[model samples]
Target: MTNEELQTLVKTISIDVFKKPFLHQAKHNPRLRTTGGRYMLADHTIEINPLVFKVHGMDELVGVIKHELCHYHLHLEGKGYRHRDEDFRKLLNETSSPRFCKPLAAQNKKSTSFYIYECESCKLKYKRKRRVNVQKYRCGKCAGAISIQINK
Candidate 1:
């Protein structure tokens, strides 16, 4: 969505959910790598990760908006707005906003060990992140026995 649309959405959500009008800007930020959205303490602006709508769909986008709104409203009122604060937690629960955003699908990478297996009879290769029992796992190419060729 364009920045203008985002601004409208944030404003609407603020009034609809919190009974407060959001006066600051809300914009899509492509540079946000690890968060779905963030509330700017300096400007009261909200920057949403563009990937939130593209990857998580509208429901998730709204959740992120609500979450940021919680921060925005609470901070403006001089209430505790940090995640660990009681007032922040209370507002989040009252608004039914998510405590934390679901991780974006695109960033959920796990570091793993690589295991390469080769079939003894067909020479078929298989790459797996976790080790497999060679005795239990066989090659699909020829129903042949498999052995690990490399581990890294």
Candidate 2:
């Protein structure tokens, strides 16, 4: 959705869910990375990661909005607004807002490479970028046998 649409949606959600109107602006912020949305403490505005809607759809978008709204309303009322606050936690439960925004599918789409190994005797863990010969390798700490598991 466009920034205008996002603004309208945030306003609507603020009223419908919080019983409080959202006076500040809401917009899609391209610079937002892993976060689904952010509530600006300075301006009381909301910035949403556009990839939220693009990768997860409307439900996820609404979830992000709701999460940010918790911050918005609590901060405005001078109550506990941060993620760790009791008031914020209560409001989140009351409004059914997600504790944390869901990770965007786009983030999961990035290429990943890793090799996991566990020593047979000592159960020590190791991660490496390249594959290693299990028979030739041993745990450094205990000199236990090593095995490899590739993850991508």
Candidate 3:
């Protein structure tokens, strides 16, 4: 959604859940890598990760907005606003906001290891993560001698 839309949503959520008005800005921040949303203590503005909407959908986006709003309202009212604060925790529970943001799907990709080997007799394909000596290791399917292949 656009920044204007985000601003409107934040304002609506603030009043609906916290019974307070949010007079600060709310905008999509593409630079936000891990966090779903962040509340700026100095400026009271809220920055939301655009990927949250794309990856997790509107419900997650609303939850994140609520989470940040907890910080926003609490900080504005001179109450405990940090994650460890009792006031913050209580507000979170009252509003049903998530304690922590959900992990991004893009950050969940697995890393894989690649290894290469060759058959001594037929020069067949082989791949492994650990090295195997030709004298001790043989191809299981063909029972052929195995050798490591280094690529230049």
Error of 3 at 78 (Å): 1.0
Error of 1 at 68 (Å): 0.4
lDDT of each: 0.92, 0.88, 0.89
Candidate 1 residue spans exceeding 4 A from truth: 106-152
**lDDT per residue, candidate 3, 1-152, as tens digits?**
89999999999998988888999899999998989999998898899999999989999999999999999888888999999999999989989999988897656645466568888788787876666676887887789888778632
Off by over 4 Å in 3: 108-152
Model 1 Cα lDDT, one tens digit per residue, 73-137: 99999999999999999999999999877888655567777999999998988999888999997
lDDT of 2 at 132: 85
Minimum summed lDDT over a 10-residue window in model 1 is located at 104-113
Reference-based TM-score, model 2? 0.70
TM-score of each: 0.71, 0.70, 0.71
Candidate 2 clashes between residue pairs 3 or more apart in a chain or in different chains? none
TM-score of 1: 0.71
Instruction: Return the lDDT, model 1, position 143.
Output: 93
